[model samples]
Target: MRIAMWSGPRNLSTAMMYSFGARADFTAMDEPFYAAYLKATGLDHPMRDAVLAAQEQDPALVPLGFVQDGTRHLYMKHMAQHMIDGFPLDWAEDCVNIHLIRHPARVIASYAEKREAPRLADIGFDRQLMLFERLGGLVTDSADIRADPEGMLRRLCAAIDLPFDPAMLHWPAGPRAEDGVWAPHWYGAIHRSTGFAGPEGELPELKGAEAEVLEAAMPYYERLFAERLKNS
Candidate 1:
């Protein structure tokens, strides 16, 4: 089973990767395009060097190739925004694509906490919303996963035609193949976690400039997200 998990920043994408990686038979890759993307575009993304290093050191090359051959079960995690540069959509026709979403306010809050002056404007939420709308049925809303990881995973498995496995609910402590490259900081919570914990505290409050940016982006995203939810 080949699977691509698409999500925005701070949307539990890495956690989902951990969940999938917990499975004995599954091989997982984290944002494989990220290193190449930064290198190609010359964008000064945070932790760019580390991301490039991970790409250099990643040992899943052959496994990923096999997965692409429509053989083994593989999971690739990606950020929706990264699709802007024309990622190869046709590469995974036999693969299941899962879209992970969180409330924009919360996503912005998380991004702000992790980066310097992060804003919905900076990430181009409008463009992401448009791309997501275009993808339509290929996307899976992950907001409910916060309340019910196992149930949601089961549903996701069913959607992708895989048997639900309990092992996916509990990952071992520490990293698998996709860690240490951007670890110690980018993967702090997920690296230490064993399973999904229910949505925990209130999302950090947005204020001043950040608040303005989010407010500007909300109406458009809300409409797009609503459409996705209604159709899904």
Candidate 2:
């Protein structure tokens, strides 16, 4: 079995990857197409040169050869926006998929701290909704996972037809080999975390165009949020 966990920036994607990596039965992959995305768009992200140099520049490489050496039950952590304009996506249908969403307000605030002014596309909410509509799979919210890790994760596993492993609730405090080359720039908080933290306090206000982007993304977020796995 293979799982493609589709998520946007500033979501709990890395943590979810760590959780799955902790499981003895699973092999986790971190944003395998990131290098390809960078190479294709030439987005000047932090460590742009380093990220492009670290992995295969081919977008199809990861999904096409996902389970190298017959590794069963691989978990792939992916950013939806990484599926660029020219990339082929027919390969995605081969894996069970899940969309991980966070509130646009929270995402924008967190993302702005790392990079310059962000548009809605930078956060990948639009791409996530597009993939969700086309692929038709499970949806999980970062808030839901943060609020109730075990319950929400169990629901996720059940939804995807996998058994819930207790290891998914915790992981060691350190990085693993599967982390993307950009880990140093973006993974500090999650690297320090051993388990899911509680829901964060309300984020500060969005300013000007940031506010407009959040407003535009809310309906798409609400649409996915409605289908999130219930803990009960």
Candidate 3:
């Protein structure tokens, strides 16, 4: 099985990758498309050079052959907002698609803490909205999985027609081959965790310009997510 898990920033995407990679029979890959994206667009994303360098060193990190043989299961983590160049969607037919979402407020707060400059609204909600609209049946909410990791895992497995293995719930501490080379900088906290931590409450007030940006993004997010729910 080939699975592509899509998500917005700060939506526990890395953690979900950790969960899937825990399975002994599964081989997982991180955001391989990112490096190609940065290279192709010349966009000065955070840690842009490092991402390109990593892909240069490991061609496997870039999309090449499908996991058509040895690996019983293969997984890829994706940032939904980053599907701008149409790379991942081009390969959507090659894998089962999964979308993960979080509240715009919390997502903004998390990204703000990391000093990320782009907000959801800045990324063009209509673009993301269209992605989800096109990939409707493939979407799944992170909050739903957070509410019941085990149950949700089973459901997800079923959705993609894979058996639910307990091993999918935990992974050995530390990095794996497919982890983004920038993991040390961006995924420090997730690297320390072993398994899913149930959903938590929203962060406190996100004041200033960031707060305003999040507020502006909320309605568009609501529309997209609501449409996703209705379709799902």
Predicted model with the maximum TM-score: 2
Check candidate 3 and list the clashing pairs: none
* Count of clashes in candidate 1: 1
Per-candidate TM-score against the hidden true structure: 0.82, 0.96, 0.84
Q: Where is the poorest 10-residue window by lDDT in model 2?
A: 62-71
Give candidate 2 misplaced runs (Cα > 4 Å): 68-71
Arrange candidates, best lDDT first: 2, 3, 1
By summed lDDT, the worst window of 10 consecutive residues in model 1 runs over: 57-66
Q: Rate the local accuracy (lDDT) of all candidates.
A: 0.67, 0.87, 0.70
- After the best TM-score superposition of candidate 3, give how far the Cα of residue 60 lies from its true spot, in angstroms: 14
Over 97-184, each residue of candidate 2 has an lDDT whose tens digit, in order, gives: 8999999899888898988768877888888889999888899889889998998988888888899999999988877878988999
lDDT of 3 by residue, 126-226 (tens): 45566666765455666777777888788777777788899877877777766887787778777777887777886557778767777777776777566
Backbone clash numbers for all candidates listed: 1, 0, 0
Better of 1 and 2 by lDDT: 2
lDDT of 1 by residue, 10-69 (tens): 878888888887777678777766666666567787777877776632322322543432
lDDT score, residue 57, model 2? 90
Candidates 2 and 3: which is better by TM-score? 2
Query: What lDDT is obtained when candidate 1 is compared to the true structure?
Result: 0.67
